[model samples]
Target: MPVPGFADRWRIEPVGAMRVPGVVFASAALLPQVAEEEALRQVANVATLPGIVEASFAMPDVHWGYGFPIGGVAATDVEDGGIVSPGGVGFDISCGVRLLAAPVTLGEVGAALRRLMDRLGVTIPRGLGSGGVWHLPDAGALRKVLEGGARAAAQAGLGTEADLRRCEDGGVLVGADAAQVGERALARGLHQVGSLGSGNHFLEVQVVEKVDDPTTAAAFGLSASQVCVMIHCGSRGLGHQICSDHVRLMRDAMARYAITVPDAQLACVPVRSPEGRSYLAAMAAAANYGRANRQALTVTTRAAFAEALGTSAGSLQLVYDVSHNLAKLEHHDIGGSERLLCVHRKGATRALPPGHPDLPDDLRPFGQPVLVPGSMGTASYVLTGVVPGEAFASACHGAGRTMSRHAALRHVRGAELCRRLEASGIAVRASSLRGLAEEAPEAYKDIYEVVATCERAGLARRVARLRPIGVVKG
Candidate 1:
């Protein structure tokens, strides 16, 4: 039911073994669709996780997922025997979005848009089984990437200090134990360190079509008509294998720990347990790899822009890079006391408010920049965290999927979609038309509505709106 005074908020009062109630952030228009899915039930199931603090929260873009709903956020008290679940983090660990601000404006790139798109299409390595821009020579090299993340890439001259400063966690996820990463996971990551894997992953060239908050937009280094690059992907096979390996291990170890979850998919173990510690270590490694993957893509994008527009790679400045998946141990005030909690965000972006110590020195006054990618050839948004953020300072990741890829394929043809996008002045380059069809704009919830609902819910404030001019799909 809707929260009494909050139009965008709904609360599912505990009815079963739930330790907390379930809170869903969504507008009246989006609520019906969200409720029709199994996501609401998953939200309830998540509330039952041991030691979970506050309510099990779902973002406005909630959708059905493996265990916890894709747009789920939950924090558990560590000292109170909190548990960590692989399902809570999802398979694509650290799968996130990064935005790069270009020196040129849309007008400046006129007539050269196609050329730029063409250069990026061939240069940006994407799609499943495609080798990345940077290939590790051996397991040792892969280990370095898993440990150092984008910092490792920067050390190799593939990135810069400025780039690291803009990344979450300074580009490297701490507590990563490369030794915990299995051989199979390592093998999968070796040749795919800098690539965008398939299924909704993309490299998009966009222009700031509207500045909702001019002051905030300027602080984020964005202006109307300015060009930008948004890259969306994840840790790829390496992250997948890590999540799979850890889920199996946790499932087997759950019985011994006496942990019982409503669903087998929600298998978890105590935060201090051996299995839990091991999974966090491996998850961190995969998170680092995901960061490194995006960093490498950033390098590739810079080169493509330089070659196509006769500009220097330095012309592009990273606005920010944030992940929507994975879990982290954070300190939050609870009942008048600060406690360490394991915060799990699956398909949700962390939105640190203004004046947050975690923000970069220059961006602290403006708040953390939250990148929200829309479906192919649609409008995306740049949001900033607000004070008193709900759901543990988390917000929606993207315009959440409404139809399954299979359903999307049934409604749209790849070739036809490509023609339509091109006719609408958006350049489209995709490895597979079938894959392209799966990401049709109609297949997603309205991006505008999701962000607006987020704002009403006080999760984040919109800074700018972006319109995609070109896209390279995996």
Candidate 2:
């Protein structure tokens, strides 16, 4: 079938055996960038895959990526010989966002904001190969984290049980076979559990400035005067190594299975194949490690806040934790029939609507909390999921990068950007000046616009808006 026409900025065409047509959402303002990017081509390639049920979709933030676009979504029928692509999961497996609410208000911390920022900068390690506060775990302990996620951390007395309830999949993925993980992957992950890895990763202290949906905001434990912390990281080198190892394995398997794709990066095998099952198991293990990593960071962050503010750690509570880069087994209604499918979300968040069974009991009435982190020195948003939307109940993960690190460094000056952010009341800390320039606010799209689009498109509804008070980046 020919793609339904819309605007000149986007062109979509159906491929063989696609149950649904492909959709590309872009604007005239972004046409040149989209045209030059490989993301659109990847979208077409994804549509050619076996068992792809609905449309292969790309958001306005779409950019060139390994196999699918950075902002891509695809759902495959698991029972119909569907395939799982390592490229779909990306290198940073379970790379996600975690948000925390503080008992104190912004006014209470205003006078000490600078001091706190400095103290946090000194306490937290950031940058390449930065070691964390946790001792490296042995193989046995590492397996526990790979299988138990934040629940394991809670059992170790790192966080409260409530934290697990607020995290997606309760901070764990079932069927994780740690035995399938390599020794090197285990070693790299053990010590890096609580560390914030470099490249667009950060921890920010923010103040809730606006509440768009009062009922939903209340359900999420967020209020206009409340302060929150957002952490963005992944499974570190462990996840990267898993992806690398499987991509090579899958490339060979693809050829052996007589599968051909437009891009080598899109290498994949049938979901029922031996190689596919193994990759899923290892991926789940790495994803669990990522949840535990965030939980560990939360423990450290709570301690830091308590000591700095002369309060108790119990005063800090988890709001939500969501994974953006992942593939999950879910049931979604299609053509009036409910069927199980594997949904691949790369740079996209799972936004389950209100009353969704997967949500915690307390939060089910409001909907799933979606954390959309902006680039450094900008505002981030807290949104709630809604039903009957495009892209299989998913939304953009962040204010997607509009420029590359190299491009940003060439065009932006680090010192000048720092001064500008400081002038706006945001304290900035970094290990490298060049790194700072690479994550400059100008390097990303306007987050407000992105969130607004999500709302208008019915993917998610805005609950609260937050502006940065302090930022620590790697």
Candidate 3:
């Protein structure tokens, strides 16, 4: 099949043992690159898994990854032989984006951008294993974080009950089993909560440069030139440790279950099986850790902003928080019947359309907020979910990485990129210049093109566009 340009989607007809078809959403110009990276092969490989429903889907930002392509979406039937793969959730479980809208504008903070950024830099710790944000005190306190997520963080005086509803799953995944998590995994992340991780993860201070839809902008309390904070982080070492732990368990269990996948990275077990339940429970606990992590960071951030900008932290209200890497058992219409499915969205965001009951009462009328952060010094987007989305109510996460970190570092010096971004009015602060170079804007796909493709593909609808003023990376 020659890649399509104008077609809505390019379908990969099943061959051999694929259980379902493969679909890649990209423009004709992007299709060649997608193929060049062999991301399509990963999509096809995902379709071979047991109990895969409908098709294996990829967003326009699709790129090569371990098991499923980055931006991959796949659902498996629980009633059938549905299985859960660790690769589907990625190593950074619940790695996601949370955006806070502020009443301030660029005019108000533009002068103090450096000071504000400096405060944020000192407030939020960075890099892998660099923990110090919140001292959990002991393992039992850590267990509360794993079990209760942001709500627990709130109870600890981090935020408030008002913040709970603003987060997805009310800042808690109900079924997290902290006991399933090993002490080693706990040790990896117990102290890392609320800190930004290395590579890709960042906290950016931005301004709403454009409001694509006034009604949505109003609903989201966003206006042109209004300042906002975009936080992109995850569960830190805890999630990585959990994923690594279960991949080993599942790899061992697969033989006993008589299951085999096209890729060893795609190691998995049946969702209803004992191993599967254990993994899910542990994953949930890690996810809760992720939520609590972001919440703590949010509170820390609010204080930093207040001290730097001389405003109350309460003024920085949360717009929405959504995880891009996760596996959630959601109900969807399939074959004319509602069935529960383990929807795995790696490097993808959930785009539930307007009227979703899960949406908070304040945001139900507008739709769930889909936060897509672009590359360094690039434009981020705030989108509203579209009803009956094409890809399991999912959308692209970031402008999916276009190159490897090594490739990016080889292409440009971090110091040079930082100078260029600063010259463009974006204040850049990174843990290291070398790390900054690895995340240069050139290392990722065009956010505009990617979001447009998603809109064209009916995955999400744009609401507003965010432009960065200051950035801090880990």
Q: Which candidate is the best by TM-score?
A: 1
Collision pairs in model 1 = none
RMSD (Cα, Å) of candidate 1? 0.9
The residue-by-residue lDDT of candidate 2 on 328-356, one tens digit each, is 88888888998888889998998888888
**Model 1, range 248-282, lDDT digits (tens) per residue?**
99899999988899888899998988988999999
TM-score of each: 0.99, 0.95, 0.98
At residue 380, what lDDT does model 2 achieve?
95
Task: Tell me the whole-model lDDT of each prediction, alpha carbons only.
Answer: 0.93, 0.84, 0.89
- CA lDDT, candidate 3, residue 284: 92
* Candidate 3 per-residue C-alpha lDDT over 226-341 given as tens digits, one digit per residue, 9 for 90 to 100: 99999999988889999999999999899988899988889999999999999999999988998888888898888888888886633788888899999999999999999889
Error of model 1, residue 414, in angstroms: 1.1
Task: Tell me which residue pairs clash in candidate 2.
Answer: none
Candidate 2 residue runs with Cα over 4 Å from true position: 1-11, 15-20, 27-33
